[model samples]
Target: MQAPGGAILEGFIDLLVEDGDGLRVVDYKTDQVALKEVDERFAGYRLQGAAYALLAAGVTGRPVTRVDFVFTDSGEVRSLAGAELAVQVAEIRTRLERAPGEEPSGGGDDQLRLPGLNGS
Candidate 1:
């Protein structure tokens, strides 16, 4: 997938479900956390969910009405929708568009790193 700024965003989503409401992006998490604290523990995953939602929407040509993080360890699901999901996606996009020579944080094996940025 490609972001609006022409940056390549590639990933494999765990699941993508389509229904009358539109597309739903689902990402599986194996993190072990208490059910009551799942939301707080996995809050950082919102960006990942948002990215999947955007990619799924782009490929399917449908609106992504929901993004879900299914916690396998606790059998809990955290969902983001409406304006919250939109804001997350927008924030992620803004972080992705780095100026020349600017280094992006969270550069790791799992995260997508843009080439030619910060000497990468």
Candidate 2:
């Protein structure tokens, strides 16, 4: 779903848990292989988690400290928590706020100078 402000937030989480520490964003996957890092599936889910965290924080008035992805098929669960998740969310929000032609910090597309196209 798209946020009212126009951010294209995608993916719906399976569950959200909250307690004294903070909110925990949980998403279930039925993949055959388990994921260990921020690959495509993980990246997509991470954004979804961040969006959920934002919504939960607004409602509860407390920061969300965790986001998790559970692969039921493999029975493997991976999680990103605390300040790290917060930082990731912030970084994603920054990317969403960027205007056209504005490159992200640390040079994403600048590294590849397409041989003959730009006289490399």
Candidate 3:
């Protein structure tokens, strides 16, 4: 899906539910974050949730107003919406648009683990 800033996004959505006038993205995670750290530890996941929101909105032509991260390990849910959601999505797009030669901030990685990248 093409995001607002022209960033291409693709992912397998765990669940999609209609929420009145908009859609909500729900993702199940096994991360072992404690209940108290649900939101704080969700730092980088904010980008991932934003990506899911952007992808779903672009593909379905519907506003993705919510992204919920369900941490089964702690049985906690971290939710992002409204302004916060928009901010994160824009951040992801900006990251995607960065020049190839520029070094990334915050430990030089976006924290998404992958094969042969970001120390994964």
What ranges in model 2 sit over 4 Å off?
Answer: 1-11, 34-45, 100-120
> How much lDDT does each candidate structure score?
0.73, 0.57, 0.70
- Per-residue lDDT of candidate 2, residues 1-120 (tens digit): 332334443434567787567778777776565455325456555545665666556566787788787778767776767776877668656654654334333321222221222233
The pairs that clash in candidate 2 are none
Candidate 3 lDDT by residue in tens digits, 1-120: 543333444566789999989999988887587778776767757877876787788789999999998889988887999999999878766765654333223311232322221222
The predicted structure with the larger lDDT, 2 or 3, is: 3
Candidate 3 least-lDDT 10 residues? 107-116
Which residue pairs overlap in candidate 1's backbone? Answer: none
Q: Can you list the residue pairs that collide in candidate 3?
A: none
- How displaced is residue 43 in candidate 1, in Å? 1.1
Give the 10-residue window scoring lowest on summed lDDT in candidate 2: 107-116
Candidate 3 residue spans exceeding 4 A from truth: 3-7, 100-120
What root-mean-square deviation over C-alphas does model 2 reach?
9.4
Give, for candidate 1, the lowest lDDT window spanning 10 residues.
Answer: 106-115
lDDT (Cα, tens digit) per residue for candidate 1, span 41-80: 6677777777777778888889999988888998998898
Candidate 3 global TM-score: 0.75
